[model samples]
Target: MEASKVIHAIYNDDDVLMHAVKKVKAAKHHIEEIYTPFPVHGLDKAMGLAPTRLAICAFMYGCVGLTVAILMMNFIMIEDWPQDIGGKPSFSYLENMPAFVPIMFELTVFFAAHLMVITFYLRSKMWPFKKAENPDPRTTDDHFLMEIPVHGNQQELHDLLAQTGAVEINVVDKAH
Candidate 1:
């Protein structure tokens, strides 16, 4: 793989980072990546990234969980062992659905939360013992870092980043 130079611009505040992102986009510069200590609202939109489909996935997972819960409850309460609980031997899932509603709801939330996390981890290419990709450790605490590829316009890009209120800027060779 060929090594290419990239510019790393560090910012202290998220507002400044957002403003710099907008300015960089307005100038037609492509932002490779941005690392922030916390979630910055509207940063994805400003970076022109596509909206995530995690919500849709979560909904589907929830549906699956609800179906499983319904089937399991029906089999257990109605078909497998029709018990005379509270002297009500209905043997019908519909009749006993009210009692199963809580289980269904809990399973739905559990599946959505757990599956969504696994899907996110897989989709993000994260795995056990995976090497960290963070360029700056400070970004994990308070600062924000923006990465832009340098294409023979290092001086121009450096000056532009500096004008956008970057506290520190560095040119580093990155391998792809």
Candidate 2:
């Protein structure tokens, strides 16, 4: 977590930022990261990131949750220890299935919520005891940041950023 070299262009205009990103990308320079105060539509494509797989992951996770809910409720209410306090039959799944819905729904929600949280935590590398990694505070408020690594033509990259109407530019040495 020490020092590494990073060059960032700070922009106040989202339009300018968008145009700038497109220009640099079209020129075939890879953009390392983009930080905006608010979401910008189509920025992901401009940054050359493929569409996210989170939706598919969510669907799969939800299915697992629902399946577990159904199985658990079936085992507990119908199979292991059946009781007939209300004189309702528990011998048939289809007969008592409607009544078992509430617990099934509850468990479904519980599992989905828990598993999604775990997935998010693991995917984002976030842990309760882990230290946070954040950029400058100003970038979160009024400014947007576009970080480009210094591979080659560092000066030309800075110049290109300035030409794109960046209000401020900074070269950071974040090497460890």
Candidate 3:
């Protein structure tokens, strides 16, 4: 496959980067991606990204965890082996639900957290021992990098990025 030309505009401050994103979008330029040292609030809205459905997935996972906890506790305490504790030999799951609240809460949180991490990894196509795709390492520390495809308008893009307070601009040929 052939390599595609892209522009990497580096910014030192996130405020400037946010403004630059707005300007780039206003100029009808398609921003391929942006990298930052930390999570920048509202960056997704600025980039016009669609809302993520991860929250829904988390809720579902929590429900699944709750269900599992209830079933396991019921089977252990009621059906499999009925234990007479605290002078209550009723052997009913509903009566003993209060004692299992903490367990259910912990399992719910555990499932939501672990499943969300796995979902995010799969969604991002990330796995153990994978190669990094970042164009610049400074973005992982103190810099912000904005990537825009170069469609034979390098000069215009460079000028626009310069006006947006980019500290440096480099044309990169990225291989797919």
Candidate 4:
């Protein structure tokens, strides 16, 4: 059971929103979340959020995909089947490599793209087969939302949010 103060603001311009957020931060209030219809360039820095690690994950997943492609192809073509169907040289890694390339490439691309997407989705809390927990339906459209958790001193918090130019304010109690 906890309580949080939330502010909802509608801004057509990202610059205005950035200015408001910077003011709120300068007043030392904790921002729980910010919702927008589109990405705002400087919003992350303004909100004090750490940079995303998705690129590192993508690189690792791509390496894994390459490894999987190589291993599966090598195991099937060399050890398991050892086929000489085209009258090519026997046990030739180089000659048969060209033929297996399409499948290998397909597997590599499939694994890399799919895994990387999944990783990003999961990291961003957008994983498949999971329900979306959108706080408001209107946030998906024209409105921009800024939610702040009131860390201390309720009156001070309210005054600060007011000074930051919040269009609408709400205090929600999660405890039943």
How would you encode candidate 4's per-residue C-alpha lDDT over 80-159 as one tens digit per residue? 88877768754956768888778777876787789888877777788558876656676788667777665456677667
lDDT of 1 at 89: 83
Distance (Å) between predicted and true CA of 19, model 1?
A: 0.8
Question: Which stretches in model 3 have alpha-carbon errors above 4 Å?
Answer: none
Model 1 lDDT tens row, 60-146: 999999999999998888999899989888579998888889999999999999999999999999999999999999999999999
What are the models' TM-scores? 0.96, 0.87, 0.97, 0.78
Candidate lDDT values, in order: 0.95, 0.83, 0.95, 0.73
Model 4 residue runs over 4 Å out of place are 10-12, 85-87, 126-131, 152-165, 174-176
* Each prediction's RMSD to truth: 1.0, 2.2, 1.0, 2.9
Order of quality (lDDT):
1, 3, 2, 4
- lDDT per residue (tens digit) for residues 48-134 in model 2: 898887767777777887898888867887898777859896786788887878877777677777887888899989989998555
- In model 4, state the lDDT of residue 142: 66
Clashes of each: 0, 6, 0, 0
- Tell me how candidate 4 scores on lDDT: 0.73
Error of 2 at 63 (Å): 1.8
